[model samples]
Target: MHIVITGANRGIGKTLAGRYRAQGHDVTGTARDGSAEVVLDVTDTGHHADMAAQLGDQPVDLLICNAGVYLDKAERIDGYPAEMWAQTFAANVTGVFLTVQSLLPNLRASQGKIAILSSQMASHTRAPGGSYIYRASKAAALNLGRNLAADLRGDGIAVGIYHPGWVQTDMGGAAAAITVDEAADGLVDRFAALSLDTSGCFETYEGQPHDY
Candidate 1:
């Protein structure tokens, strides 16, 4: 499994990178800080393309768009900073959209799988909004995954969206139910077990599907 992951310098993405590397798979991770195998600021569509080119002609087997943002204490929809909302969408939604869409040719050649990191907050099932920006961004990402699944099905490429659960990362906070290691490991296991027939499902790291 040659995997390319975003936001791999810390949290769940970092954990996933380490796990894959330990399992002897070729893993390329991207971070804006350039600390990972590749530097990728996913908001910059051109940079995403450049990173793909940097990997040469080899097809990436699995691409994980795991970078995201959380509004923290400044959570509000009515009067939140528009810049923050834009930035959040840049990393959370547009970044994932562009990266996956731009890399479709390579993915098609490999018949690869793409996993977009979404959140339970994306769930319209339980929507009420304190973390307005975070929720909206993730919701948009979920829809992005759905659209990609539909678009790429003919290419034999599988697309999925997943929530990492409330993991104990900086974004998830200390009281979150799982650890980064736990969440990453669970997601990897679930990824390996997914069938093409079930590709578009939005699932948790634990493999239970969530309602869109």
Candidate 2:
């Protein structure tokens, strides 16, 4: 698979990139730091379109909208500044939407899959308070995934929204349970097994589908 992955400098995204590349798949990994295998920013909408053009028709088979930020360093929901919510959404929802939209043509051409990196926190049925910014952004991302599934159905592109569990990464923190490697592997396995009938469902890191 020729895949485009965002947030590839660290955590699950980085680990997934390594795994796919090791399997001899062509991978384009993007991060804020240019040190990524391919330097790209999901937040930069213009750059997304440019990269799609530059790819020159060698369309990516999978588009992983994985770039996001957590405002753990800031105040919690009850007393947090409203600006943080905007900033979080800018990077999470808005950035994700732009990245997916920009690469949509390629995905259509390949009859590919779009996997959105959402979180368990986004599940409304299981919602709680706190981490307001993260929760809201992820919720929007989940909805976006649903919308994309509907919009891309004609192109035979499947959309998946998955929660990678609480992996021990920069965002997930050091005390989290799973490792990036384990989460990435499971997600890849789950993704490979999904079909259009299963698109737009919520899935766990271990490949278990979660009902929304």
Candidate 3:
């Protein structure tokens, strides 16, 4: 199986890449700093184009849209600047869309699946009020993945939006509830279980259905 993962330089993405490689699967990991097999700043369409060109018709069995930002984590209710919202949305929402769009042909070729790593914060049921930008962006990403599943189902592509758990990563922080390996392992199973029948599902890393 050929897997493509964005933001694979660290955190859960890196763990997933390592796990897949250990299982003897072909993995293409992308990072903005060129540390991985492909250099991709997901917010950049030109980078997406370059990535697609580099892959050049390689069938992608799984495309993991894991690149995202949580810039307003420390911001107060009155502190989130407009530029911060723009930057966060650009990375967390638009970036996901562009990656999927650019890789559409590859996904179609392989009849692959898409796994979007949104957050539980994206859920309307879990509104704790802080990190508004991140929450809204993730919600948009969830919506994007759901609609993409509908549109791509005819082409034999399945899309599943997932909350990768409160993981102990830089973004999730050291106090997070789960280890990176735990999140990655659960997510790998969730990704494997995704099908057209469950394409538009919003699920947790542990494979439980999440409220939209």
Candidate 4:
């Protein structure tokens, strides 16, 4: 499959890129800087245009919106700054939208799938009160993916939102549950299982149904 992943310089995104490539799938991985085959800073609309130009009508089978930020890791109520909220939303929410929007034509041509890497924190049932920005951003992403699924179903494009399982990555830290490869592998399987019938699903890395 011809796949595109964002924020692939390290962590789960990086691992997924390598695994997919090793399995003989064509993978275009992007980073904020010029560090991959596609130097796509997801929030940058110009970069999205550049990426589309680079692909130049190449059909994409799968697009993984994996680029995100967790800036409000442990912010107090008064400590949550305004700029922090803006930056976090830009990377986590708007970035996903831009990538998907820029690649719509290619996805439509291929009848493809989109996998949004959201978090368990995105769920309203799991609100623990900390990391307000990250939680809110992820929730917005989940909402975005669901609505996109509804709108794009007629175009034969499927969209799914997933929690990558609190992986042991730079963002997840050392004490997290799973390794990047494990999470990536599970997510790859999840992506493969995505379809028009199951579009807008919110699932875990292991394929379990998640409450939204």
Off by over 4 Å in 1: 76-78
The pairs that clash in candidate 4 are none
Clash counts for all predictions: 0, 0, 0, 0
Estimate the overall C-alpha local distance difference test score of candidate 1.
0.87
| Top TM-score hit | 3
Cα lDDT tens digits for candidate 1, 12-74: 999999999999999989999889888789899778878878887778889988987786446
Q: How close is candidate 1 to the true structure, as a TM-score?
A: 0.95
Which pairs clash (backbone N, Cα, C closer than 3 Å) in model 1? none
Worst 10-residue stretch by lDDT in candidate 1? 71-80
lDDT of 2 by residue, 38-57 (tens): 66767776677777777767
Which window of 10 residues has the lowest lDDT sum in candidate 4?
32-41
Tens-place lDDT per residue, model 3, 72-187, is 98999779999999999999999999999999899999999999999999999999789899999999999999999989999999999999999999999999999999999999
Would you list the C-alpha lDDT of every candidate in the order shown? 0.87, 0.84, 0.95, 0.94
> What C-alpha lDDT does candidate 4 achieve relative to the native structure?
0.94
Q: Among these predicted structures, which one has the highest lDDT?
A: 3
Give the lDDT of residue 195 in candidate 2.
72
Those runs of model 4 whose alpha carbons end farther than 4 Å from true positions after fitting are none
lDDT for 4 in candidate 3 is: 96
